[model samples]
Target: MSIEVGSKLQGKVTGITNFGAFVELPGGSTGLVHISEVADNYVKDINEFLTVGDEVEVKVLNVESDGKIGLSIRKAKEAPPQEREQRRPQKRSPRNQGNNRREQLSFEDKMNRFLKDSEERLASLKRNTESKRGGRNTKRG
Candidate 1:
């Protein structure tokens, strides 16, 4: 059978290589499915996904001028996207959670916290600036 772009067909894998696999289509025509096109996930090794004589469905991506056919297994049998669970759980802000929000801090406490943060930021900025300009102890005589 003649192969054309956008045609899907089942073919036997004739050979497997590091970069791709050669599939023999019906009527003895062979095409290559690149390693990256083998699956949706990262494929470090193509052998893990395909082997010689394994029949796989492939979509014809292109028909080159020199009779080379580029195929994609991932696109041929496109799997429905699986719902992925969130890796990181939603975090609750400490200030909005529990007793911290229930207890009202006095103005003095808020001012103290703000002052401490300001002092730390200023100290960090000074240290960063000083280090950039030949460091704290580098007063040249």
Candidate 2:
């Protein structure tokens, strides 16, 4: 059967490499499931996830013009809506909120805030260093 993009197919793992796993699809076509596509989480080693002779369901990501097939095992498995929602980051605290606050601010406002914070930090650092210097400014014998 011809492989089509977005189609899920059951294939057997033919070979495992550091970068990816080669699966032998139907009609004898082989495809590479990259390490990054092996799972939703980080995969340090492909062997930890897949092995030769293991049957896995993979979604066809792309079929290159040169006959290379790109597949994803993670995408093939659909997660429940609730489970998917659980994986999403929750509302962040004001201090931990990353770029959301900065993105809403105007360029001038952001620059001013940055400058104020920087000046404060610099002043604090200077005070710390000056205090560490033993009797630098004191009347010495």
Candidate 3:
């Protein structure tokens, strides 16, 4: 059978690796389901969601000319729009977004803040280097 992109297929987990799991599709063809495509949330370990010999329905994401097939188990399982939206990260409110701080502060205030931070950083760097060079009182021959 020809494997087409976007087509859902039945596959069995053949192998598992740190990065992804290999699935054997119809016609004895194998494809890789990346760790990210295994589930909607973070997947630190692919073994947590799949195992060898497990039957799973996967969606064909891409079929490369080199015979590499990209598959996704999460995409195969359809979810309602509401659920999909819920899984997505929500946008932060304007008050919570700190990007507008520069716009809120005057130019003078920003300059003053920058000068203060720079001074503090310079002092810390000087102190660290002086200590590493056998202290400020040490004389070089």
lDDT at 56, model 2? 98
TM-score of each model, paired residue for residue: 0.56, 0.59, 0.58
Give the best candidate by lDDT: 3
> Which scores higher on lDDT, 1 or 2?
2
Clashes of 1: 0
lDDT of 1 by residue, 1-141 (tens): 788899899999999999999999988999999999999999999989998999999999999999999999999886435523344346767765786653588889889989999999999998888877988566777
lDDT of model 1, residue 114: 90
66 Cα displacement, candidate 3 (Å): 0.6
TM-score of structure candidate 1: 0.56
lDDT of each: 0.89, 0.92, 0.94
Candidate 2 residue lDDT tens string, 1-141: 889999999999999999999999999999999999999999998898898999999999999999999999999997878998999889877776776766899989989999999999998988778767753664455
* Cα error, candidate 1, residue 140 (Å): 30
Off by over 4 Å in 1: 79-141
Clashes of each: 0, 0, 0
Q: Which candidate has the highest TM-score of all? A: 2
1 versus 3: better lDDT goes to: 3
